[model samples]
Target: MTRRFLFAPLIAVALFAACRPSPEPGAGGITQVATIDALLAGAYDGTVTLAELRRFGDFGIGTFHALDGEMILLDGVFYKVRGDGSVGEPPQSETTPFASVTHFRADVREELPAGLDLPALEARIDRLLPQANRFCAFRVRGEFRHVRVRSVPAQSKPYRPLVAVTRNQPMFTLQGVRGTLVGFRSPSFVKGVNVPGYHLHFLADDRRSGGHVLEFTAATSTLEADTLHDFLTIRLPAPGAAFEKVDLTPDRSGELEEAEKNPAVRD
Candidate 1:
């Protein structure tokens, strides 16, 4: 009788689960706003607001229109990390030229070992990946032995290519700190469309400082990963002179690498 009673509840639970609606497409996948090519080709015009971006996903990284500042999305809130190493919540009216976000349900959670530099951390994370071509989102939180981050100030009309804008970016390095690293790892096939490898942004525990992560050393960090297999959706800005006139035909991979990896514009 006890066995039959348990079986009855199991059947009822199965029926209830079967009746539940499937998750929507956006809820299950990554929603990318704009293209890396457009941003590279000097399209700093924001077409999506923070409010709209939030609706698609709550956790991700992206920059504001005109490449104003580094953007860090955490716990459903959007923050702007500036060149002066200041972090604040920008007005919701502000928009983003390029951003990638996911609803962030981690499929893998692990506690990584201590004393890993950027390359080592990447190599270790590489082993954890199930495949090379798939897109994945990563979030690591812990004490960083050293972290180099950079942020660019806003530009005016007649925007310059990302490479040029990065030339004047401000770099900051924090040592022996507690913080979180948020970013995405795109496949090599998406190179020109998005960063081919890991593109990460850092936010300190105090929430007072952050920027695009250039390098870092971690100590027993916790890593959470979410695989994005559903789709990558891109939203472009409306037809305008800014985006229409920009020349995107040239290959800017080398230039982008220089800018993103070692843009040391100031002393």
Candidate 2:
């Protein structure tokens, strides 16, 4: 079975790292398919085809229609990290309900230190890319000492909020794996529009396993930060009952925190 390799979460404390950067303020635009609020509200059906999404940018992160799997768009290729912890290249015909993409071009490059965990890495990078008000898309490639990631199962109709769906999300643990972490650092003002902090997805070099990266410690890696200085486009989903009828007025940052940061609340 494709789900054969799923593993329990592994706990490990991580350390801080340092970086050197020379920013190239602008190059590509950031195109997002739908707002994060919509996804958190259980509007899982997608309207934007990956084929069309390619027109906007090449590298980014998001999920598939029906919330089927985690998405990793690297070097113009779209890869799906399934709930089973297996990786596959989904067809361009498939649509994404929520996604963020950019024609990734490295503006600053740095070699990160060993044993740096997610928080530490984010902290280090934050210092280097101090433009907290601007969007930053990064690609971190290297060998990982340990990686913990998760992906929720495909949701059926009459969908529950994302927090509800991920309560029993499948978690995976990978050690001694080589991969690339793809994600973005959005401004705090983008809370409803996108993740306020960092939202990252990982894909192993073999492209055989990956998911929404929960935590990790890098053994060795290189960082590419693209400080986006171009325009930002937020595309609305096609008019449909799922998106149109859903209530998005409430503040769900608390909900989003649990959904994005917390691991499976239940087995």
Candidate 3:
């Protein structure tokens, strides 16, 4: 796999000494399709084709190009969980701006406790992590007492920024349901490059509903995690006129953080 581990000069010696060799591609590692930086910079136009996405990994979460719908990769199938909360298969022509996937070979599996909301559930998972810096992908399956999610509608060209789009996102809450939560816990250093900490998306058992998970209370669920030691492979959109003209110099970390966790940034 293509690996990039250029540590800062101050910590290069110590960090390099502790780092392990990156594994070859397709070897139980996280294969992310695009960078969050592009999304934050408003590269909503489709870049990587769906056909190209499947070649990387199967279980992951992302949004369709133009933010048309939320994406859920479950059981090797890509489902477009749209703003109306309807789930359907997007065409092979559909594309994604950002996505992270892995073959999903769980190295750890355990039962989760009941009555835990998003923060509690995250804390529980945090305790189980082998290390803070290593990449980890999660797949939690089972019944949920309650779940709250949000999905944004497709935007026209000359699209508004994601923060504005999220402000108008449609939210849904379902009770007494079975589903799977697909997500990853990226290192804090990634910050603007990707969402640090847990970023999860949910898909129901009936495959009728799902979106970006805001909150959830699991009754009895199993949490499966794949610890990724392999380096990340990032793909950027084909630099076209629109991509080249758009200014990506500003840091949108604050807005992205609010949009992601609160779901009420506009309120």
lDDT of each: 0.84, 0.87, 0.81
lDDT of 2: 0.87
Best-performing candidate as measured by TM-score: 2
**Which 10 consecutive positions of candidate 2 have the poorest summed lDDT?**
9-18
| Residues 53-73, model 1: lDDT tens digits | 887788899899888899999
Clashing pairs in 3: none
TM-score of candidate 1 relative to the true fold: 0.87
Residue-wise C-alpha lDDT for candidate 2, range 189-255, written one tens digit per residue? 9989899999999999999989998899999999999998877888887765477887889999988
Give TM per candidate.
0.87, 0.87, 0.86
For model 3, the local distance difference test gives 0.81
Candidate 1 regions exceeding 4 Å error are 1-25, 263-267
